[model samples]
Target chain A: MALGLAALLFIVLCALPVFYMLGVSLVGADGAFSLNHYFRLFAEVRQLDLFLNSLLLATATSLLATAIGAPLGVLLARADLPAKRALRILLIIPLAVPPYVMGLAWIYMGSDSGIIAQATGRDFLSPLTYSLTGAVIVLSVSFYPLAMLAAEAAARGVDARMEEAALLVAAPRRVLWRITLPIAAPSIAAAALLIFVLALSEFGVPGLLRVPVFTTEVFTAFSALYDFGAATALAVPLLALALMAGITARFMIGERLLVGRRGARNRSPLSLNSRRAGLAVTIALALFVLLPIAALALETGRAERMILALRSSVEAITNSLTLAFVGATMAALIGLLLGYARARMHRFAGTVDLAMIVAFAAPGTVIGVGLIGLWNRPGLMEEIYRSRLIILIAYLARLIPVAALILAAGARQVPASFEEAGEVAGAKWTRVFARITVPQMRAGIIAAWVVSFILAFGELGATVLVAPPGQATLPAHIYTLIANAPSGEVAALALTQSAVVMTLLALFAVFVFREKRLHS
Target chain B: MNDSFLRLVNIVKRFGRREVVRNLSLEAAEGEVVALLGPSGCGKTTVLRVIAGLEAPDEGEVWIAGRKVASDGINIEGPRARHVGFVFQDLALWPHMTVAGNLDFALASVSVARRERAARITEALRMARIESFASSYPDQLSGGEQQRAALARAIVSRPGLLLLDEPMSSLDTELKGELIGEIAALQRSLQVTTVYITHDRAEAAALAHRVAILREGRIERIDEIASL
Candidate 1:
């Protein structure tokens, strides 16, 4: 009964906005069924350009990310390397730092009088800096870790004995090519598709780079033009793309999407030349992780400017931290119930997974538009729309699906027999869950919270659209300051945001390490 | 013993601080089926692995077919160069490939010509009584069929030595008896030096010319199957 309520709440909170948008898009001004909005969306040259741009960006980013990430993943999973754990954590730092911050770094590095110009005494990279290619590069750098981690997990999950079986008659290289990579291919492809969807859905990087994608167009349609109908129309293609990609990814991954199991006892036979691989990894780290951060710090100039930037944006920062904290807690609590239900349900679990993936994959601008259409009404709905509460709602809508995914993966790790044992000992269902299940899921719960908080803290697309006047979050504030305020201040704020996210991730990593040590 | 086709001398394998196989030594003559019989964690599988060159012992040497394949703490020749076949406990059939494809992969690895590969694959499938499932993937086949497929893949390359790591552990008693008889017949025909690891005493007795009982990584005794 409790699980049913949680599912209902999830549907209402997460699914309703998208559904409402779909419904609203199908209706004309006369309140009758119509296809005029879609017709207009299809007929316009500008809309066509937007569609192509979105498609190109998503495709390019996914391809580049996979090309860079899959080899690293193979190395991480199979190679004999030094300080692998540390390297892994460092590589993942780009994912935690928001893409827009990376965009800001690129802007600072490639601007007319920026770092590159000052160093080289010429403005060579500025043309490529604030363009679609720039957006693709920035987003790929920010999101490649997703592909890397996915590929690594999938590779590790392959039975080592299977490779050994091949090794009996084949060289190690042949075994890897014929057996290991083929087995891990489905998962790698799925991660690439997911990266495509994420890149397609992303708003801030494109907006910063002045790339006219669907997300940025939707923002302009609603926020600049006040054309709600146009905004909803613009979201249709993006939503369709996301839905298709999510369903395809889910099919490719199946149950392994959430749960990663370690393989057999034998070590993989495939090995890399550690010195050369280490050199490549170090170079990648320099390019993808350290360069952007150094640019941000360099552009921020001095410590005093950072302090002043912090003082000026203190309200926005505080608002962001508080809202993200509450949002993450609620998301984790709700995710716990829903995730447990999804994990345990033998039937309808695929449907639940589909819904969660689609929800999570829906672009934030689309969700923002949907929320506005749903909540910007009279009475109680208007109360939410006109206050800071709407931002939290937006956060929940955008974040719950991911939190549920993390928690569901956690729930799967706790064996069913443990709960059955608790029940056999005369414990009630709730008691068994609280004592036997939740305790075992402690690490998962913490992971869900930390991930949710990071995502919510960096959330910009939905929050920017839905936040009331004077209730700007740090991302929205930094975004606005990009046009008017000094570059130093904007760089400082972006640096501060990255620092907070990195610190939280570090703490979570430390906690997880300690937990593993304790258990082992 | 001097003409043994497969030999392990004072093998010691450790995982972390636990010595899984310690000071264990054994030998099997050419065409001999020697069963390494032990309870779980008695290092039976480790011994098979050492002979196969899949593992290097920390303090021993392994010789296969008159060649030194591994020395203390090093694999002088890897598993492929040793020409040993292994059927893991889980079967470990490549799920992405058909049974024919699996066999073809093994054959092709040894530089078998494409023109001759099909005939070899067909003969192996026929020997294992799994010709009907040649185009089927491992998951598409039944448990018994999968077992046959694994066995066919192992022997398709005509390996000098064969290692079976409790491959029949998951089967019921009836199926186990059937497969054991088939395996014994296959071994007699192929005349490959074989090391079968199993905790089941009856299985060891039914298939082996000699049974070496292992207790805590040490040989307790080697009894002739006829005596048992």
Candidate 2:
């Protein structure tokens, strides 16, 4: 009972802000009931423009990210590539960069006092940061990890024996297309939809680049203009779009796509054997993944950069760590409840799980917009909206699904006989769950918490719009510093944030390694 | 006459369009060792699960110690409420838990005080001869150790009925013989009604007081092991 309530409390708190956003969006005018705000979106041209921009950005970004990420995923999962571990880590490192930070990095590369201007002695601001192309680049870089991870997961789930059978029958290419890709298509589509939803609600990249999209419009209406009704109306379109994308993604990729069966084969990276092709791909990867960080490092000399970065480093680290801790703890608790609910409530499990997945697909900024629209009204939430509590709520709504999926997968691996053993020992369901279920899922719970922590710490889109003014997180802080400060100062801050993220990842890697050793 | 400890009457189970366990009847008398022996896909495991209330039968009934727990499409009790213990082929001991914790989790709500629970743990551990490995986690234990741990956990609750599903399948030949001897001794000591399922004819012949051979989801023969 205690465990269940803890789980319930965690889920309720996480879900409250997003649910309240929807509830408030439905509130009527004249101090009564109406769908005026929802209807008003269609009547406004600017709202429609912003809606289209968001849709275009999401669709284009998902496709581009998937296109680039799919080959990389295949190389990592199935090929016998050289330096496999090193390349995998290198490809994944870009994920540690927050979306706003990536935008800031691009700004440094393309702004008036930027690297391109400094290097080429020509102003390139017209085609760079302040355009839609910039927004696409930012969103694509921010989300390609989704595609890569999905492809790898899908490829891993294919039974090696099946592939081997195809190879022996002299149908390698046929098997690759028909058997492998089709079997894993659900996961690839799911990844693309996730990226699409993420791009749809992204606000910071577009905001930084001055590309007007729905999320930015909603942010402007609420925060700048203080027009709650107008903002709510604009957000209605985004909400509908988010729901549509989630449903479409769910249909394209089933729930099983989210949870893959871990296989035992040692995945070897693909060999890029053609000399010219190898060099070309390597150069492309280096440009995409390594060049920005390298420039950030070079622009800021190591000594001066370290000194400036260290000044506020302690405070930023503390804030990021604390928020991540809270978010992870909250997410883990909710994950436990959801996992249990899925396991125990067999009949309604699929539907409830689908709802959670859809909510997960909804982006942080969209949730933030919804929260503001809901709470900034002339009502009880007016008070809550003014506090840091609202930001926490936004984080909860955006992150719980991630933790739940991990926990659910882990929970499923536990055989039913363990629970049965407890019951046969005369333990009630409640007691059995506490003594058996909780203990068995401890590692999964911890892993879920860690994942949530990493994601929450790097979250920029929602935090940029929702965080109380001047209370900048690491990502937000770096973004602002990059816009105004010298190249060295900005690079120092970016490097520091990267270091913090890398350190957490290292710790997590150590835990995973230990677990594997223990199991083996 | 008193009823048998556990009974299954005309149980039928189907998956999709195929019937896995066709109208099958089975019973385990008090303190009797009843072994359901069969080849793969013969539905021995399905029948055992049905009796344990883990799987529902499309037809027929189940009784435990004179009480009808499932019958005529009515399942009045779930697996937890059936007071039945199951030992899976994989052991299914919680891998993250210590050996002692494994036993304690099973005996969670029993009125045993902390000291008494510890004593019970010690007794079960000693009985299973796994006392020295009490603090070790399941993954650290050997296959034989896991077999012992599974048995200790199942019997710790003093269940009215016990079910073992291919208990020695994962063990080596040496460990299998050793564990099988220990299990037979433990069953004799506890006098618990047990229904052991195995595909191995030799195992059933060696351990069961009465052995039932199942073929294609139906009973081919049920007789005393000595006569068989």
Candidate 3:
């Protein structure tokens, strides 16, 4: 009964926004069923431009990310490089630093009065810095880690003996091409498609770089033009694109989307030259991880400015921290029940997985518009919408699906027999869950919370749209300050956000290492 | 011993701090079937890997077909150049390829002429009695058919040495008996130098001309099957 309630809540919180948007998009001004919004979307050249630009960004980002990330993944999985654990963590730091923040760093480095301009006494890079290419670069740098991690896991999952079987007749390179890569191709392709969808759905990087994609266009139509109908129309293309990509990725990845299991103990057939691979890793870290951060610090200039920026944005920062904490807790708790149900489900689990993937893939601006359309009027919901609670609801709408995915992967690791044994001992379902199941999945629960907190903290697209007056989160404040406030203050705030996320990640890593030691 | 086609001398292999194969030595004459029989983790499979150049021993030498393939913690020759055929315990058939495709890949790797490749694959499939399943992927085939496909893939390149590591462990007893008989006949006809690893004494006794019993990481004794 609890599990059923959790599923119902999941649908209500996560799925309803997308459904409401779909329903609204189909209704005309006359309140009759119509396809006029889509018709207008198709007829307008500006809309076509938006579509093409979004497609170009997503495609280029996916291809570049995969090109850079897949080989790095193979190297990490198969090469005899030094300090592998540290290298992986360092590579992943760019992902934890949100794309918008990275965009800010690039702007500081390349804008007319920015670092490069000061260093070179010229404005050579500003054109590329503020263009669509800039958006793609920033988004790719932020998302390639997704592809890298996915490819690493996929490569590691290939049976070592299969490669060995090929090795007996073929060279290591041929074996890698014929045996290892072919087996891992599906997963790597799925990850690329997922990155494509995420790039399409991204609002902040494109918005910051002045790229007029669907997500940014949706935000403009709603906030600047006050044309709700136009915004809803703009969001339809993004929704359809996300749905298609989500279903395809889910099909390609199947149950292994989140559940990572290492294969046998034998060494892989493929091994890269350690020195060359190490050089590549170093260059990547410098370009993607260190450069942007150093730019931020350089622009921020001094410690006092960072403190002053923090003090000025104290309310927003506190709101972000408190809301992320509460939101992550709620998301983790709800995700635990839903994930347990999804994991134990023998039927319709695929359907549930598809729904979660679509919800997670839905662009933030689309969900924000959907939430406004759903709750901006009508008694109780209107009251909630007028208060700070609407921002929390937005967080739930955006984060619950990802939390459930992480927790479901965790839940799948615990065997069913453990619960069955609890039942045989006459323990109630709640007791069994609390004592036996939850204890076993403690690591998953913490991981889910940490992931949720990070996502919610960096969340800007939905929160900016849904926040009540004077209740802005840190991301919203930083975004609004980008154009109005001093560049130094904005850089300091962005740097602060990155620091918080990195500290949390470091702490999580420490916890994991300690757990591994204790268990070993 | 000097004329042995496959030889291991003073092999010592360690994974981390634990020694897995400790100063083990073994030999198989040309066309002879030697079974390294032992309990699980008795280093029999490691010995097969060492001989095939899949692994280099920490303190030993391996000679296959009169070539020093590995010595002093280094692989002098890689697995491909060693011309070895290995059938792993799990079979490890490539799932993405059809049975014929698998055999074709093996033959092509050895630089078999493209014009003769189809006939070689067909001959291998025919020898393994899996000719009708050439178009089928490994997952589409039955357990026994998959085993035959794995065996066909192993011998497709006409390798100089053959290594089998509990290839029939997953099959039922009746099928195991039938496959064992077929394998013995195939070995006799091909005259390939073979090293078979098994924990089952019955399998060792049934097909091996000689059995080397191992305990921990060392050989306890070598017995001629005629004496057994």
Candidate 4:
């Protein structure tokens, strides 16, 4: 079946590289199977420190993000706040902008000559600008919407009658605490764990913040020291941590996590009327949504410099745009089949969910190292590994699972009876899928494509690791120049990244609105 | 002055100008049972909701236990403030709470002391004949058992007015008949003012002191139902 090939493609592209790295981690210099690599990994105090730093960073990001996002999510789902739809869209704009660009904005705000210093005529935030706490703040602000969305879904999942039953006797606040929040605990915890994994796997934020985490160390080991063994070894711990967290999150959410919250729209029982909730949403919008973006624009003032910055990094920009397009297109196409297969699958689907999340959560540095271990050999494999094709491979490995998950969520919306109706009419399975099922899920498909494109465009971690020597993507170039280049030029590049991403996001939003109108 | 404990006067409810309930008026005396019978979409549930203070009337006045609770374009009191017990058509039992916890929540809502909550909940469970299933969640209990739990939750706070909206709509004929008998006995013993909303004429005849047949959101007829 076509679905089998899509599944097989993921197994070969994503799964094999990880397995290859696992094999490499197990083998010693003598070419004998051994635990020496792991032994050495734990034995070195520097490695242990790196591991601890990564853990703390992940923990802090998860906790802080949840703290900020969970309340907002609850408000969005239950509050009778004004301009709710606008507020939700504004809050989610951060997800469109890459985390590193956010880090860059924060840096500009907190640097010695940056916004905070110039405005205040003193430097308080500059000391903590490139610190672990700074990384946590940037990553948390960038990823908080994940928690927010998850929280809203979980809150909506609570049946209206359940709350009304409580409201018959208990106060609304008591009903929320005792009935709504407790029921939503699994989703909130799952979102927290997901944030933890994402923060741990993140390379851009911590790297920019000068936080010496596993990802950065792995980069240093391979790129600077040329010690492939050491780099691969460093990745094992991060890989293990991301996989564990991803699997745990998947289990916590179960199959319902993939079912979108369309069912929640009709049942609106919990209505909160409070001025304080409105104030909280406004403050959150100003702080998390508007502030960083305003800082970025303020730092990059002139149009001419932005033009010059784009021209200078022209090769990198071209490569990034082209590769991202190709990568997103491939990911969407392949993800459709995989998503459909997964949606229709009844038995052992949990295992598939676990596998996808683990793959999707694998640290970019680890996947890059795994790809090199698997393909950097003499003959045909070496030939392909040295080309730009390898970079595309990295993108496929990193992003396909995410795309598939999105599509699967969409696919689940189509009732099984629709497909069954087609089959009963003597249509083939492919025809049934295309004419009946796919048409019903058109919105989900477009959403999946847009999300996939955005993620692919902003991808840096794995691309940075796997890019051929002397080659640079826009992100890799901007990051490399930040140390030595003028603030104006760096700001321009960062702003350009935001502009392109936002413009595409606007287009996608328009497309979705148009589709909704047509459907209506 | 109305002689009834629960009264709705010239109540009007509209959802986007469809006018669900138009100039509807009803009353139930203290410690009396009155059944409002109608076809589906006859605004029977809306009347119950208006009385329970869950839904505000567009043009009407609702008074519970001699206190004005809601009027045209204003909800003067919330469901909790009016001390009303409402069991929805679906028997909206909180799935998260155990049967005892459900009763406890009801008692707590009426601001009962934590110490007395346990005893009150037990007595409520005993009255509903579901004492052995105190630890059971709504989903864990059988349909009949769950029905008892919902009844227990409603009466736990000892509300001045009790509203039932097709509570046995999902039950089989055997269980429905049994619950109807039990509910009648409980209403007689407790002597709380009650309004029963149902489409089934048999249900109306089985429990009510009087039956009001509703058509197009208006009272078509009022007949005294002889005791079954």
The lDDT ranking, best first, is 1, 3, 4, 2
State the interface C-alpha RMSD of candidate 1. 0.8
Chain A TM per prediction: 0.97, 0.87, 0.96, 0.95
- Over B38-117, each residue of candidate 2 has an lDDT whose tens digit, in order, gives 88889987787677665678899889888888887677776556777678766667544588976776665444577778
lDDT tens digits, residue span A56-88, model 1: 999999999998888888888988888787789
Candidates sorted by DockQ, best first: 3, 1, 4, 2
- For model 4, state the Cα shift of residue B80 in Å: 1.2
* TM-score per model over all chains: 0.97, 0.64, 0.96, 0.96
Candidates, DockQ: 0.83, 0.01, 0.89, 0.67
lDDT of 3 by residue, A1-520 (tens): 8888888878888999888888888889999999988888788888778899999999999998898889889889988888787788889888888789999999988888777788789999888998988888888899899889878988998988998888888888888888888999998999899899999999999999999999999899899998788888788788889888988887887888656655656767677688898889889998888889988999999999999999999999999999999999999999999888888888998888889988998889989999998889989989999988999999998889998999999899999999999999999999999999999999999999998999999999999899999999999999999989999999999999999999988888888888988999
Q: Candidate 3: which stretches are off by over 4 Å? A: A116-124
TM-score of 4: 0.96
True contacts kept of each: 0.92, 0.00, 0.97, 0.67
- Pairs in clash, predicted candidate 4: none
Residues A199-255 of candidate 4: C-alpha lDDT, one tens digit per residue? 999999998988999998888888788877778778788878987887787777777
lDDT (Cα, tens digit) per residue for candidate 1, span B1-228: 389998888889998899988898888899999999989988898888888777789988998878888998999998889987788899999999999999999999999999899999999999999999999989898888999999999999888888999999999999999999999999999999999999999999989999999998899898897775
Q: List the residue pairs that clash in candidate 2.
A: A28-A34, A79-A268, A79-A269, A81-A269
Distance from true location, Cα of A242 in model 3, Å = 1.1
i-RMSD per candidate, Å? 0.8, 19.8, 0.8, 1.6
- Model 4: chain B TM-score relative to the native chain B: 0.96
Better of 1 and 4 by DockQ: 1
Put down candidate 2 lDDT per residue, A147-230, tens digits, no spaces. Answer: 887887778776553343222222345546644666577788888988888788777788888888987887777768876666
